[model samples]
Target: MLPKKVKKRASLLAITLLVTVIGIFFILKSLNKNILYFKSPTDIKNNQNINFDKKIRVGGMVKKDSLIIKEEEIKFIITDFNNEINISFSGTVPNLFSEEKGVVAEGKLQDKTFFIADRILAKHDENYMPPELKDIMKKNAK
Candidate 1:
């Protein structure tokens, strides 16, 4: 026969474990709302029904000859080889932003595959040479 104290301690331990597990579950559920996902234009094109309320990052190359600036609003098309998505933003663009460059826009998609960007991030390659140009230079050097 087990002692009374031992049985009480075992029960208390079990309850504590259950409470800890439930606390962890709620913590993880809340944290999930803070996590944003990144996708490409092709991914967005394939999954057109994604929830628009949530924030996300979209990465792609700025399509050539697609940039249009009108007063405060700037519009461009981002392409991921397989698909292109039009983006519009009314804010100061990054200094490095230009046509045919790789960019990641943080925003949400609106109607008709239009991305309303809240922020635009443009990346520059090291050595002052763009990645595409660097690749060409490397091939020629070899």
Candidate 2:
């Protein structure tokens, strides 16, 4: 038979370990819910399971001639050559945003073909220079 003091200490240690494990589980679950993963148009097409409620980012090149603006809202398509997803946004986009440019739209997926974006992020290459900077450089050269 184990001594009473040793038995008490062992039970306490077991309880502490269980509590720590449960706390860790909750933290990991919360992180899993909050983390937003970037997916390409082709990934969205090939993946069979997609969480519609969770916000996700779809990144790809803007399909040429797929941009449509109406008042404050804009609609465009993102394609990865193999597949494409339609993105709809209702806010002002960055000046760098245009057709045939790389873009990442953060929002929720309404379906396999349609996505409703809360934000649009335009991507530019390292060589990209802002218009103001370009003008300044040209003036300096003159």
Candidate 3:
């Protein structure tokens, strides 16, 4: 038989562990809903099923000479060299956003080829390139 103090301590420890676990579970649940997956243009092209209603982030280098800035819209093509996805964004352009630069567009796909971006994120520095994007560029360079 366990002593009274020991039993009380055990119950307190169990409650602490349960509370911690419940806290973690809720945190993960919240994150799962808000998580945005990053995909390259090649990944998008190869996948046949994509949810148009869900927002996703697409990362790639902007295709050279493919940017067109109109009065109301900005259109560009992002390419991993193997495939390309056209992006249409209506928002303030980031200073780092330019042709031949790394950019990530967050939006829903109107179709497989066309993406309507609600937000555009550009690299903060010149040396910043996503590891996946770097690998894709290196594989295509050879």
Best by TM-score: 2
Candidates, ranked, TM-score: 2, 3, 1
* Candidate 1: tens digits of C-alpha lDDT, residues 34-96: 553467777777774788897788888899999999998999999988888999998888888
lDDT ranking from best candidate downward: 2, 3, 1
Question: On a 0 to 100 scale, what is the lDDT of residue 93 in model 3?
Answer: 79
Name the lDDT of candidate 3. Answer: 0.90
Error of 3 at 101 (Å): 0.5
77-116 per-residue lDDT for model 3 (tens digits): 9998899999999989788899998899999999999999
Of the candidates shown, which would achieve the greatest lDDT relative to the real structure?
A: 2
TM-score of 1: 0.61
Question: lDDT scores for all predictions?
Answer: 0.85, 0.91, 0.90
Which runs of model 3 end up more than 4 angstroms from their true locations? 1-37, 124-142
* 1 versus 3: better TM-score goes to: 3
Q: Output the lDDT of residue 127, model 1.
A: 50
